[model samples]
Target: MTERDFDEIAALALKHTGIVLGRHKANMVYGRIARRLRQTGYRNFADYLEYLKDNFRDESTNFINLITTNLTSFYRESHHFDFLRDTVIPELKKKSDKKVRIWSSGCSIGQEAYTIAFTLAEAHMASAFDVKILATDLDSNVVSTGAEGVYPADSLMSVPDDAVEKFFEKNRTGNQVRVKKSIRDLVHFKRLNLLEGWPMKGKFDVIFCRNVVIYFNRETQKTLFNRYADYLPVGGYLIIGHSESLNGLTDRFKSLGNTIYQKIY
Candidate 1:
């Protein structure tokens, strides 16, 4: 891929999805999207760029799918689940509405959402309330995979061992596992571009937006953090990626440590 071609692709990704791609990401971008060149029979990135200009609809979706990083697993950053099981769920249970509403923003491949599902199940919170999880990502491919609820059986290892039998059923191949219908029913996966207006209605009690904003610039992060605050009511919680912080980003939330925050009116 030529440097000029790479620059064009980078610009397209940012324009469509709000994911910032710095010079350092050039190599990673090339590695991720080279398969597109091969599949489309384009001899080089230059040829692919020409096609992308005319086929932006089909190509951009595939481009974003290929370029965006989607590294996620069940109960990734496990302690967050501990807090949910031990603290958050119990508190939400006592509320007058008897509802549990969670938004797993950037819920790649559904493991994080499933982990939320299993944790709520273990706490006996899944069926008791009108529970719902909104799992969204800009990439439609990952959203489809998440909604399908199938994964390598070994991914079950990321959560408590007991959770495997409770929430997932093995595929006929026995090498793969799919989330049980009960758990799957709890999550609703959709295609969402965070930079665009959200179509969702109503507030969320707890939002898990981990590892999603590291690719965005500060201004974008600030806007997003503020939007998150709007989606949450006073005392609602927001869980971010361990590497991310809200320090100096916004004052809408109070730090509860370990990258957790609570809305403070």
Candidate 2:
């Protein structure tokens, strides 16, 4: 691909997905876009770029799905869930009505959302509380797969044996597992581009946007956190990846242990 072709694809991605492609990322862009070219039956990269520009809506959606990286697992960063179970949930239960709302932003393939639901159900709060988890992802493919709630057995390796036996059914046909209906019903997955204005309504008691902002530029991170602050109530929890920090971003949150932040409004 020519330099101009890479620049155009990167610009289109940044415009639609808010993902910035640095100078060294040209090869990455080529590898991803090349697949899209073959899928669309385009002759070359230049033809694919032109098609994307002409057929903005459909191609843009496909491009977003192709370029977005979705790497997630059940109970990733286990400590955050532990903190939620031991600290946040107990406190919320004491002061509030038995209703809880959580937004799992950038929840790739639904593992994190399911993990949240499993934790709540294990805590025996499923029937007592009005629990709902909203999971969103930029990639349509991952969002649909997550909604299906099927996985390979390897994906359940980290899940406790009891929980796995209780919540997932093993598929004999091919090393597959399906999340039980009880757990699947608790989450709602949607396609959300974090760069655009949020369309969700109501504030959440907790928001899990872990590991997403690390791919964005610092300015994007600041804006994303500000938006998270806007959507959370005072003392609501914001759980980020362990490798991430808000140190240079904003002061609206006070650090809680285990990579969790409490909105201090």
Candidate 3:
């Protein structure tokens, strides 16, 4: 790929998905875009890019899916689940409305949302409250996968034995498992871009946007954090990836440490 081609691809990614792609990402971008070229019958980066610009309305979703990263697993960051079980759920239990909403923003392939469902079930919240988990991603492919709620058996490796037994049902081949209906019923999956408008109307009690903002530039991160704060009320929780922090970004939340923040002002 030419330097100009990479630059154009990077620019499209940033504009559509808010993901920053520096010069170092050229090799990775080349491989991904090359796959698109093969599928679209283009022979070169220049040709594909020109076609992309002309057919953007029809092709943007494929382009976004090709470039955005979706790396996630069930309970990948276990500590966040620990806090949800130990603190968040308990506090939420006291609310008179008995309704709760948790968003797994940037949720990849549904593991994080399922994990949240598992935690809530373990706490008996599903039986006691009106609970729902919204799982969203920029990639339609992953969003569909998440909606299907079926995964390889090994995806449960990090989950506790009892919880796994309770939440998932293995297939006849025993290599895959489907999230039980009881749990699947508590979550909804949709495709969303953080850079675009949100259709959700109510405030969320907890928002888990873990490991998603690291791919964005500082300005984008600042905007997203503020948007998250807007979606949450005072004392509502914002849980981010372990590698991300709110320091010097915004003051609407106070650090609860371990990458957990609560809206205070």
Candidate 4:
């Protein structure tokens, strides 16, 4: 693909999703989107670009899905779940009205959300408080998969053994597992673009965004973190990816280490 063609596609992605595609991704973009060209009967990137202008309203959805990376696994960042179980949820129950809210902002396929729910269940908060976990992702496809709550059996490797035994049922082949009703009932999945406005009404006790902002520009990161702070009350928790830190990004949260932060002000 030519630089001009790559630039146009990148610009569209950034404008619509707030995700920046560096020049280095040009080859990767071409490789992934080439199938769309074949399906649409376009012979080249230039033709595809021209075609997308008129059809982007519909095609952009698919394009965004193809471009946005959805790399997640059950408790991929195990420490965050440990903190939730060991510390956060207990503290939240101590202060709240016997109801707690947690958001998995870039929830991807719901592992994090389910993990959070299972952690709370293990903590026995279900005995006292009603817990709600909202799992959201920009890609609707993954959102639907998360809602379905079925995954490859191997996906449970990182899940604590007790959780797997309690929360999932193996399918006939035992090659797939589906989340049980009790755990599934705790989470609600929705399609949300972080760059856009959020529709959630109540503030959350904890927000797990994790690894989502690495694709966004610094300015967008600042704006998004500020927005996250707005959704959290004083002392509410925010857990981002291990590689991410809020040090110079925003003063909205103070570091609790291990990429965890607390809304201090």
Candidate 5:
């Protein structure tokens, strides 16, 4: 693809999703979009670019999905879940009503959200707690896959045997495992562009936005973190990727170790 074409698409992505692909990302863009070009029988990036400019609604959506990264898995950053089960939930139980609202922002493939559901079910027992997990992603493809709640057996390797037996069913046709309806029902999945205005209502007790903001520019990161603080109640938890830090970002939250932050009232 030409540099101009790269710039155009990158700008459109940034404008729509707050993801900044630097000049060095041109090759990355080429690699990701090239396959789409071939699959659609377009001769080159230029043709694909023209198609995008024409703004066929479905094509545009696919183009955006092509560029967004959706690498995620269940129990990723296990320590965060440990913290949730040990520290965060215990604190929330005291302050919250029976209903606990958690947002898995940038949730990919539903694993993170499902992990939360599983944790809550195990902790509360009998599914008596009014727990709700809202999982959202910028990529519609990943969101759809997450809503399906099926996975390869290998993906469940880290999950405990008892939990697996309780939460998944083996597909006779294949080696896949489908998440039990009870667990799937605990999560609500939606396509959400974080850079856009949020349509969600109500403050959350916890927001897990792991490994997502590393791709955004510093200004975007600051804005996103502030918005997370806004959506959280006082003493609410914000858990980010282990590699991420709020250093030099904002002072709205107090560091609580383990990459966790608490919003001060």
Candidate 6:
């Protein structure tokens, strides 16, 4: 792709998704766009760009899904789940409402959300307390997949055998497993653009926006962080990715180490 071509595509991505696609991502972007070209029956980048501009109303979703990265796995960041089990749940148990809400913002394909469900199930929360996990992503494709709650059998390699048996049922092919109804019921998957307005009416007890802000600029990060703060009450939790930090961005939260932050003000 020419420099001009990459610039236009990057600009369009930023406009729609608030994701920064620096020149360094040119090759990766080119590859994904090529897949789009093949799917859309376009002959070249320039032609695809022209078609995209005219058909944006119909194609913008595909463009955004192509540009956005969705890299996630069950217990991908195990420590976060550990903290949820060891700290967050116990704290919630003490509350009188007996209701718990956790959001997996930018949740790719529901692994993280399902992992939270597994933790809750292990703790007997399904029968003892009211629980809900909202798993949302910008990619509608992944959102649908998450709602199906089926995954490759090998994806559970990191999970212990007993837990896997308890949480998922092996399909006839044995190559895939579907999350058990009891576990899948805890999560609700939807397509959401973080840059757009959120429709959720209630504050989440914990928000897992892991690895999502790394694609946004500092200014966007600042806006998004404060927006998250607005959705959380004081002492509510915000858990981010391993590589992200809130320092110099916002002071609404106090770092509790391990990339966990508690809303303090």
TM-score versus the correct structure, for each prediction: 0.97, 0.96, 0.98, 0.96, 0.94, 0.98
Please, what are the lDDT tens digits per residue for candidate 1 over residues 1-265?
A: 7779888988988888888888888888888878888888888888788899899977888888987889999879999998998889879889898888999999989889889988888888877889999999988899999999998877777766688878878978899988889999999999999999999889999999999999888999999999999999999999999999999999999999889999997
lDDT of 2 by residue, 133-247 (tens): 9999999999999999999989988899999988898888859999999889989999988988788888999999998987788898999999999999998989999888888
Model 6 lDDT per residue over 1-265, tens place = 7899999999999988989999999999999999999998998999999989999999999999999899889987899999999998999889799989999999998898999999989988888989999999999999998999999998998887888989999999899999999899999999999999899999999999999999999999999999999988899999999999999999999999999999998
- Residue-level lDDT of model 5, residues 1-265, one tens digit each, is 8888888889888887788899898888889899898889999888888888787575867888987888888888999999989987777667546778899999989999999988888887326567789999989998998999989988998888998888899999768999999889989999998988899889998999999998888999999999999999888899999889998998999999889999985
Ranking by lDDT: 3, 6, 1, 4, 2, 5
Q: Quick one: RMSD of model 5?
A: 1.6
**Residue 60 error, candidate 2, Å:** 1.0
lDDT string, candidate 4, 5-54, tens digits:
99999999999898899998987888888977887788998988887888
Tell me the RMSD of model 2 versus the true structure. Answer: 1.3
| Candidate 3 off by > 4 Å | none
TM-score pick, better of 1 and 3: 3
Clashing pairs in 2: none
Error of 6 at 117 (Å): 0.7
How big is the positional error of residue 167 in model 6, measured in Å on the Cα after superposition?
0.4
Clash number for every model?
Answer: 0, 0, 0, 0, 0, 0
Model 6 alpha-carbon drift over 4 Å, by segment: none
Decide which is better by lDDT, 3 or 5: 3
lDDT for each residue of candidate 3 in 152-204, tens digit (9 for 90 to 100): 88888887899888999999999999999999999999999899999999999
For candidate 2, which ten residues in a row score worst on lDDT? 91-100
- Candidate-wise lDDT, in order: 0.90, 0.88, 0.93, 0.89, 0.88, 0.93
Provide the global lDDT of candidate 3 against the true structure: 0.93
Q: Report the error of model 1 at residue 106, Å.
A: 0.4
Q: Candidate 1, which ten residues in sequence have the lowest lDDT sum?
A: 153-162
